[model samples]
Target chain A: MNDSTQTAVQHRDYAGAKLGMWLFLFTEILLFGGLFLVYSVYRSMYPEDFHEAAAGLSVVLGTVNTVILLTSSLTMALAISALQRGNTRQSVLLQGATIVLGLVFLVNKYFEWSGHIHEGIFPNAPELLARSHGQVQFYGLYYVMTGLHGLHVVAGLALIGIMLSLTIRQRITREDNGKLENAGLYWHLVDLIWIYLFPLFYLIT
Target chain B: MNEQDNHIVTTKTFAAVWIALLMLTAITVSVAKMHLGAFSAFTAIAIASAKAGLVLWYFMHLKYEKRLLKFLLLVPILTLAVIIGLTFVDVWYR
Candidate 1:
């Protein structure tokens, strides 16, 4: 191959890379979308039981977690902004903050789940089964949906953690920060899912 | 597209969006406290949709992305809506 053509082949396509990321994100949305459909069907079938079961969830805790995830999103966005502006130090700090916030969110989720299990409120538990069919369905969807979302949070944290190290090592610099931007996109998508999950599961009381 | 990547959103814009999101959360919570009966779910979903929109447009930088990307995103979204709408119709009529 000619020298000029070889250099062209090595060039990074930032927008193409991001478009690919968005495609993956679209599938992620539909993955959760299926669970949402199940939740909607059951809730419509038994609105009262759904409402009753949802009340068992602490809106206070849910609200706190929501705020935590949202703030992490802000930090993640700023991290990208910082990197684009050539402030590597500030970008690294913001990325670190985002990771910490994600961990804190998981910690809060741990406590919330433990509290529910202590109450014997998990799926297929005797207490949950004893409730109406709709309530049973409600808790089933609750565990699956939130559990899946929590897993995504973990994944997003890992991605951001990698991006953080990359920033510190100068691997993700102003000129080639597509990786960091993609990570930020994934993090924001995680936050977006919770925005819907919060009200659907917690606030429909 | 490379030039678009150079666009640096100000920290002030990020903070403004953050505050707006927090306010929406508060409003949703307060509205939930009221006994709106069947309208409760509708109101909650509406507010949540608004919040989701904000996150997508700003945090995800969809607003800054090309119009073609936005149109591509609508594909999956519209599919979901159709699926939900058809299923609900069946259930409601039955």
Candidate 2:
């Protein structure tokens, strides 16, 4: 490669990359925001049924998952900082911690969902279908919103895994840490969405 | 690249923010148990917004970002507000 071409390849625009990630995050926020709007309208229409259905959700499980996700977000931030400081081992370890916590959150979600399903409270289940219209809509929105958030959690895990591998290979280092920072941004966005979701769905009652 | 120019957020800052977030979470959950009538939802949402703001500013490092990115971030939030506001008006009338 020519000298100029080599220099171009070596240069990394951290700001531009982060700007792109922020724009993508905007779309994500709006995507979830639309669902929240629907939730608000329906909630106003059926406040009582919403409360009744929300009560069926386990506060303990929801609270535990909230704390787990929050801690994972913290670990994600720490991992990026560790990477920036040239401590690849510590960075990889923190990222690993984040992934494990993400898995724990998912496991808790499984138990929570199973508990509801066992009681026949799932969307389109006979028991749920037999409920009042408001009740049915409540469960419907609950599943869709939380299920989508869970998908984001899984995606964050995959991104962090890639980051861990790259850190181990020394491909992402103190000099060029744009990818790690962007991954942290994405993970934080996941946590941000859940921050609102927890209140809107679980605590609003 | 100038490594010194890059803002290295300390462990202390992250820990303090995390603790604050957890405390906010606890407050929201406890307040939910109260019979505050219409204020309950508003209070919970307000607290949640505060938590989201802290994550965006500190954890996401928006505070350290340039003005252009900060303005870009604000645009979407404003747009969302308008959309939600108009929707609320429609819902309120019906």
Candidate 3:
């Protein structure tokens, strides 16, 4: 949200910016949509193996991370709300909280992945490969889906981090904060993906 | 964008939605513990869909956005649904 003249009243198309963000989110849904389609097909093809494989996952960790992501989405949304009300400092603080929550999610993911790896259950490991084909495919989708999701978390953190700085510098003021709003949209989309991931991967067992 | 562009959703509303989302999470987790047979997956997905709706409507401000955006969102959702529906039909019959 930069203006060339710093005093030319700063033209901004708020609706257009938000529309662009939503368009980006649609592509994201389809990107993961293809994966979800793959997941559902495999799941139907090998229901028993899928169920057994999913049971190996730690529901506790999954639930914890789900909570973390959901709360972070709230913070991200609230940060935008705070800015809309001209509460710049509060908005910045909420953005910081969102970043912290996002990092916490990744930390939980690290421990979860490490735990699986320690058990020789990672994708393509000899232990995983020796299993039924259905089980193999299950973990394959698991890693690919969650790994991709974790990357989005990292990108979202960087986006919010930038928005946080801009908000602090008053570059994203109450009147023109489309950048912050777009960042918030991206963060929420990440959370939305996790919502489906948690149940399909962790809870379905 | 006009003055109404500054639609400030109250913090209380946000807090309420947060509580609702958390409650739905808890419900989904608890539901998974039950032996609903094939319905287990279906139920869990239904609950998760509800949670997603809350995030989209409130957190993402889709509820407050223009009508065109609502239609824009319908595009991807419908496309995904059609893809999944056709694939399942083919798989189920074969």
- State which candidate has the highest DockQ: 1
Q: In terms of lDDT, which candidate is stronger, 2 or 3?
A: 3
User: Which rank order by lDDT, best down to worst?
Assistant: 1, 3, 2
What is the C-alpha interface RMSD of model 3? 3.3
lDDT of 1 at B79: 94
Candidates' TM-scores?
0.96, 0.96, 0.96
TM-score of 3: 0.96
> Across residues B47-80, which tens digit of lDDT does each residue of candidate 1 receive?
9899999999988998888899999999999999
lDDT of 3 by residue, B48-94 (tens): 99999999999999888888998999999999999999999999998
Q: Please write out the lDDT profile of model 2 over residues B1-94, one tens digit for every residue.
A: 4354579999899999999999999999999998686899899889999999999999999888778888898888898899999999988887
lDDT of 3 at B60: 93
* Global lDDT of model 2: 0.90
Error of 1 at A167 (Å): 1.0
For candidate 2, the chain B TM-score comes to 0.92
Each model's DockQ score: 0.65, 0.63, 0.64
Give the DockQ (C-alpha) for candidate 2. 0.63
Error of 2 at A121 (Å): 1.1
Docking class of 3: medium
Winning model by TM-score:
3
What is candidate 3's DockQ?
0.64
Tens digit of per-residue lDDT, candidate 2, span A72-127: 99999999998888888999999999999999999999998999999999988999
